[model samples]
Target: MAFTTVPLTALGAAPWEPNTTYQTGDIVTYGTDTYQCVQGHTSLVGWEPPNVPALWSKQSSPADTQPPTAPADVIASNVTSSTVTLTWTASTDNVGVTGYDVYNGSAVAGSSATTSYTVTGLSASTAYTFTVKAKDAAGNVSAASAPVNVTTGAPVVDTEPPTAPNNLTAPTVTTSSVSLSWTASTDNIGVAGYDIYNGTTLAGSSNTTFYTVTGLTANTSYTFTVKAKDAAGNVSTASNALTVTTLPQNSTQYEIIGYFPSWAAYDSPSFTPSNIDSSKVTVINYAFLDICWNGRHGNPSQSPDNPNPNTWTCQNGDGTVNNAPNGSIVLGDSFTDGTADGGYNQLVKMRQLKNTNPNLKLFASVGGWTWSNQFSNTANDPVTRGNFATSAVNFLRQYQFDGIDIDWEYPNSIGVPCASGQTCQRTADKANYVLLLQTLRQALDTAGQQDGKHYYITIASSANSSFLADAGGTSNWLSNAAQYLDWINIMTYDYYGPWDAASGIVSPLYNDPANTNGNSQFNINSTVTNYLNKGLPANKLTIGEPFYGYGWKGCNAGPNNNGLYQSCSGEATGGSDGSTYDFAYMQNTGLLSADSTGKYTIAGQGYTRYWNSVTQTPFLYNPSTKIFITYDDEQSVHLKNEFIKTKGLRGAMFWELNADRNRTLQSIVSNDLPH
Candidate 1:
């Protein structure tokens, strides 16, 4: 080997040259072998990697020669519009897996020390494919995990606005509020709600077509518009503008309410609106409007030969006629095109009567004893309640009514027979009745905003415990329903009638202790006291006096206790409807008269009049004829009027407008009660 001293370069190994520094763990090749530096040193001529065993050592075979196996069970979850989380089973490496590399279509999207990674900043509404790779300390990555596919969600975008509402109008306008309504708007999405604008400023909003914009200046003119909006924040153009001027505040003290039965226009001794003495009463309630099973407002169809043309004629669901009379009367004015009948024509005549008495207000009373069968159904659901309210508004506007009166007789109790496929009672009727009143109040308020006037609502309440308990469960119905109503007409009469086997005073101001077989709480005084004790404000209560009287024949007659609470063989004779006679009929026919002592006397009619000081009511007895008449005469009416003022009640109401032909009783009410 010493023959020529050949250089290490000739042996095919790079020569270790002088002046080249090497650091620890530096790898180099010499004489077909790889070596690593053990210490920092400069190269020498004879100290080659092969010759210097103590200073250099050949690098051993490479460790971790195999890369990790492909990750298993890769999944993408928790995906959102802009982000997704990825997870995978741990990969197996020849050594051990240290970390993971997440990829998006072969490009490194992210890295993770564990098996899961959350990738963010992803495009919305875009499709994407992802994978996972495993790497060891040697930096040898495995193949991508089974290709996983995903797509980001679409972006939330709102571009369409609701259409402009049409027919913007006000139903009622008051000193401080305007009731507005319009046709609802349309949208690609659903219209969420509406905003009412008063001269370009938002005054209120409503989910429905109706809205009441309050807090306005009294006696001021206001311009209003409506705008429709969607959930996406888009809004439509403003609706047509409407201008309204509010009315001055009302300062009336007393309320004199009268009932005008639509059928009265067609009945014998026909009492039309022309007969109404406007100065005798400040308000007239038109009776009545009915609800059909289909949620439409209905009244009796006019029949030329029905005698009472306004009387309702019952119709089956199939449109077939029935023997039962239709108990509802549609106002003749409800029809357009000159087809209006005497009923509607009478209503028009009444509406015009307001010009003579500017303080007079008229309302349409809906639901009565015979037509109340559908009240429970109408008020049980929101849809039906809405329909009923809309129809009520339409009816009021069409007839120029000043308000509405809901006369649902004895809710949660039986009235007349229900129409076919109709429900008359429910346990929920109490609460639903309140809801019905609330709906009507809201609708009425909205309507009142447009008309520039205050609208009123009243209820004809029963005078018994059953009516209260059934309506609100120990809570006074007046307490629950009074705020929405202008007044409650308490039917203080009707304590006893032919419905009772024994006769009693029809309307006693106080309890009668004379051999009583009836309820002690049935009299007017007890009824009013009960209501007042149960949280009814005296000012909101109007005592109801019957213009008619209940008659019983074949009863014991005496000066003591008269025929009160006496055994009656049957109903009295000579009543058009049987068992009842109007004040007019009694006086005109000389069945009742006033004695010299200012007491009502049976006088030459084979009847004797007796006064019950304890009950403060009068009854007529006929010993030979065995007839008894219980009624309120002018003296009794005067006494009741004094009682109203003493008790600080609002006023009094009569069951009818046509009953007192001579206004004998009305004269007392008009003069005795506060005007």
Candidate 2:
């Protein structure tokens, strides 16, 4: 390949190393003036100051006076009452026009990368004059284009509301919810949506005629009515009321699992094993135990035998220091799980509850995101893998846990460490992971036979299917691994987060229509369906839900397009550290508000809540702050529980318990699924 390149030394760039990892605000000089780094990234030759404008911005420069020519032939189209879409001929610039700024009268309306811009939030029955100006990257502005006058249409005033929803009927009734559907209502403008009421109190709203009113008691009668409304805030009279009684809970086998992390005890309001509602779940995955490397628990600073000296003290609840060998399971935090008097005792007590309820079981989950660095090394060899399996059995038996859950964050990838420039283990992990699982399964079965109990083996699998599958073929990894496992908990959350380019739903139920950046497959529905299609039995797949949401702080479009699937300046700096906010935290801060058992959004604290009809999830956007947060609420969990039943899947599993408020999300799972 022919190439034309300039060396940094030749360009008088001393500090700008080709492979240097620079933080934000780090400055480097290329030829003359110093350029400041806008974002942290490893510098490549092609991604220099002049190439990536988003990463490196020119700090100070020898001022250039040349400006781009004015934009020509400015015209307005799609002129609505509240908006104007304008376009103009491209402006010529010697240094290249970076973007065009649109001006309405004397104020700046908006800016666009191309010659077109959409100026919104205009008052109806108004006249406006608009102009366009071209600009370059060097902070150069051009002369304005010829002005274009536009007259806004008269405001829409629809006084007449839609007719009352007819044929109100409950097609299905569960112990906790009622699925109601009615005929569409007619309106002059159009029927926008329907709102269901529980005897005058607003229960919920739905775009479609059908609404599922949840949080009802078993064998209780609840009268519901529906009303139609339009965009003009016109609401129709209530429909004829329909009364329905819910069915009583039935006996069926479904895994209603929840993760109980040991570190949640350090939160603002600490959540321990004692806080768990024993009746709400079939199993509690105790996260997490660590794998000891050379008689010590591994830390974030880990490599092949080059582990950090600052390691965690792995000890038993009885105050015994564990000098465990490689691959042996060790307590992540010994204090959190103390003697028979502390949280560890609570875990054992929860296990004994199975005497009264056979469904309840306790499992020890190992190797979470932070502790997964040693998983690859352990699985690389037979000696380590065997050590892991044997120690796993002892860990479960000693703690009186019923099972073991391996949460090797990723097999062929060095998950969290790689985020800070660390390398993952190997591609051979594709096969070795299955070998590791097979090893543990055998050990667990041997122990189960001796103990006269069946020990479950589950893995917290990633939603990234490419990690397991070959191009245009079956996932050899899952096929080989599924036989020895009880179930695969697909981590469907965190599909998009602060690390993502577009601020999308953390765990979308279905395909998102608004997601144009090509992660449409990163959704709950697609992930579950893909697993089933790949011959993994639905019963062995557990859908994962997120209690915490991913956020974008300063979105380019505030509430336009609902601040979703939009380009954002960076991570959100909401109450949570500019990255995530739990569902409980959201409720506490009023970023979310709804009826106890309803799917409809009531309001938010300076943030507007919007729903994605296709994804079947809710998101929040604060227009004033320009922060967007995507999270799953009780309604989404209710819908997902229904999806779980419809798909004949094992059940649902959320990230952790502390992220919920007043057992909001847990109650939904307990009421819907057979525990």
Choose the strongest candidate by lDDT.
Answer: 2
Residue clash pairs of candidate 2:
553-572, 572-578
- C-alpha-based local distance difference test score of model 1: 0.70
**Each prediction's TM-score against the native?**
0.60, 0.60
Model 2: number of backbone collisions: 2
Off by over 4 Å in 2: 1-251, 302-310, 339-358, 418-424, 470-475, 558-561, 576-578, 596-600
lDDT by residue (1-675, candidate 2, tens digit) is: 233333433344455667666654566786765676644556656555644443555553344568899999999998877888899999987745656789999898865655677888998989999999987644588999999999988888789988988988775555666667688999997788989999989986776665656557768889999999997889999988998988875536689888987756544465776677778888889888888764556453423222121344456765477767667888765555555123334445546656656768888889887678778767756667888999988878887888888898777665655312222366667677877877776677667758977778899998877655742222556756775677789998888887776778888888866688857678888888778777676767899988788788777663465788888877876654347787778777766677665643655777778888888988888777888888888788889999999997888898888777458888888899977
Clashes of each: 24, 2
Model 1 lDDT at residue 569: 86
Candidate 1 off by > 4 Å: 1-252, 295-344, 419-421, 470-477, 558-561, 595-602
lDDT of every model, 2 decimals:
0.70, 0.73
